[model samples]
Target: MLVLFVLAFGLFAILNPRVFLNPINLQNMMVASPEVGILAIAMALAMLTGGIDLSLVAIANLSAITVSTMFTAIASSDPATAESLGGFIALIGVLVGALAGAVNGFLIATVGITPILATLATMQIFNGIAIVWTGGKTLYGAPAVLSSVGQATVGGIPILFLEFLVVAVLIGVLISRTPFGRRTQLQGANPTAAMYSGIRSTSVLYGTYVTTGLLGGIAGLVFLSRNPTASADYGTSYVLLVIVIAVLGGTNPTGGFATITGVVLATLVLQVVQSGFTAIRLSAYEYAIAQGVILIAVMVFDQVRVRRRPRRAPSSQTETIALAEIPRA
Candidate 1:
């Protein structure tokens, strides 16, 4: 991933040095990356558990719509009160995302529905709710403070980009330092073994989806802050883009592996490619075609790497052998 990022950056720098290397263009990439970067993190989390959350973008839209509507309504009646409670309202928006996640968790963990199917149904349901709430129109305006913070900068770094970094670091720590993260990976790798080892697969799955939901919610808030508008159909293409980011970031689509660092690097790579495309005046369709090609190439490379790699004894077999070697207690 690092190599890919460096190569992409260098190539773009060579092709469009003036525009690609411009400070303004770089800042734009930083600002634009968070919405998709954060969502990519969420998607990576789901993939870590051998599941996918197709409703993530829907959850984000719903959360953003909820926030936008509340802010607009409150600000319309009592601007002072709305200003005072802007933070609270934003928190509520994030909670809305968590609630949506809980719904997905329930359907998958409690109801035993397939992850894809459950999330697909909920995606429509969530989007439908957003449309009904907004009458299929865009809800514009957010707290002045929120928008300011979203667009703020410090030492040439975008506040939104900083937030994305914080999120990525925190998630990286959670996966690397926490027992739940270990359990999640284990569950994805071998559900039966995780069960035998007393891991509550259902709870893990539920928590996984909820966490992803929460992340989605955060992404939604960021989206609303950056754009100051919400609609049921906003970021409709992000679903696939995030998946591509996750996969390119070294996340296993089938589960049991993910890397926050890889995801971050992949995000940068895509951002550079995108900004480069714009600099070179490539059409959106061409950019999309490039994305598809990148995804396919990465998948093929991963397949080859896995195939050429030596397989190790299954952990279960290794554990059994070790247990057999031990004396009776």
Candidate 2:
């Protein structure tokens, strides 16, 4: 993120000169961070458990579509209905997200499947449901108040940023300060050891998946609120971004590691680069190349770190010296 920050401001100030660091652009960055940020946290936690949640982007898409669809349905009957039902709409979103997450947890834990395969199956499944719901229609008739949450702010900061902040802080505290969090790390680090030590590995694993699913649902709402429109194609391109944010932010895929703050920083980096791409007139497709490159680099570094920490092999040069110095035994 620091790199992207520097790259964004440096290049933009040099070229655009008048507006790169302006509050407007800064606000835009913050407003844009939530959807990815929310999903990034979920992805980070899931990856920290030695698993992945490919279904999140799909779930997010579903949530966004749900928000838009609900708003349209409610307001279509009586446009003023938003004033009355806005709170209920938000509540429904939370419930839907939580329920989806629980399903994810059950499939991974009790069903005994690899998370990658499990989530992959549901990724398509949930996405398919979103498509069927939308029937290939774009939802644009959102209630005005519901849409405001996306771009609204207080004291010069976007409310969406605050929403993301709340999630980050709440969950960060849960993971860093609580016993459940420690046990999660333990399970991720050494499942056999954690199990032998009487940790409920299945329950923890279930918790992890459900948490991912629930967060993904919330992420979906954020995406929908901000865009205030939905199509079947929602978040289809975001799966890689989700993984990139988590890994770049210092979450270990092999388990027992995560840094929520790092994930936030990583999201900033991506947004910065994305803003730069926008200013430089690069098509969105071009930025996909950038995302791909970063993913490969992050994955390589993570694998190297895991292997280096555990291998503990003597260097070839050190082994040669030991052989040479051996006594006549």
Candidate 3:
């Protein structure tokens, strides 16, 4: 996937060096990516546990909407009061996300609902709440600090991109090094075996969902910062896009395997394609079609790979030993 991303980028750069390789264009690509990229990582985490978070985008929008509403209300009466509490408002958004995630965890983990059905139901619920909160309108005029966070750069790197990078590293370490991550993999691979081994499956599931919610909330913050607006329907297309990116990044649909590195590379690849399409004046529908095709192709390839893998055969010595241990007729 990394090689594919590199090749695709090189091809684009070759085809239109004036735009594709232009510094401003490259920066724009990076800046536009963090929202979807962050959501993709969150999706990957859920998929690693043999579950899918269909409500992630909804959660993000809800979180952002909640915070933005408060900011707007305060700013209308006291702009200085709102400005002084920018960081606090952002934290509240994240907490709301966490609370939303906990709801999902309770439903799927504690209540024993199927993950897909549970998250699907929550997605609508969250989205509805957001729409109701804002009367289907957009909220803007946040603090200047948020605007700076959204647009500021250090050493030419967008702060949002830096946040994404930091999250990627943290999640990578969590999945690759932590006990909870190990248990998640084990549970996904074989829930019965993991339970029998004394792993707290409930804790693992709850933790995974909560972590996903946290990521979604953080992504919401960045999204709102970038646009300085919160809308109930913002990023509606991202739900499917993040899932596609997660699958393409080597997060198994059946669970038990995932790679943050693959997720990052795949995100870059898609972003490159998206940027190129934009440069050529492609419509949003075209982008959706491209994503749908990519998703189908990746799923088909995964099925083919699984089918082609050789099954383990018993060794001659093991077979003989088994035969010897059998009771005499």
Best by TM-score: 1
Whole-model lDDT for model 2 versus the true structure? 0.81
Q: What is the C-alpha lDDT of each candidate?
A: 0.93, 0.81, 0.89
Model 1 pairs whose backbones collide:
none
Predicted structure with the largest lDDT when compared to the true one:
1
Error of 1 at 28 (Å): 0.4
How many angstroms is residue 285 displaced in model 3 relative to the true structure, after the best TM-score fit? 2.9
lDDT (Cα, 0-100) at 200 in candidate 1: 97
Q: Compared with the true structure, what per-residue lDDT tens digits does model 2 show for residues 99-119?
A: 777777888888988889988
Instruction: Tell me how far candidate 3 lies from the true structure as C-alpha RMSD in angstroms.
Output: 2.5
Question: What does the lDDT come to for candidate 1?
Answer: 0.93
Give me candidate 1's TM-score against the actual structure.
0.94
> Mind giving the per-residue lDDT tens digits that candidate 1 earns over 1-329?
89888998999899989998999999999999999999999999999989999999999999999889998899999999998888999999999999999999999999999999999999999999999999999989887777998878999999999999999999999887899999999988888899999999889988999999999999999998788999999999999999999999999889899999999999998998899999988988998998888888888998899899997867998899999999997
Off by over 4 Å in 1: 310-329
Minimum summed lDDT over a 10-residue window in model 1 is located at 142-151
- The TM-score values for the models, in the order shown, are 0.94, 0.85, 0.92
- Backbone clash count for every predicted candidate, in the order shown: 0, 0, 0
RMSD for each of the candidates: 2.7, 5.9, 2.5
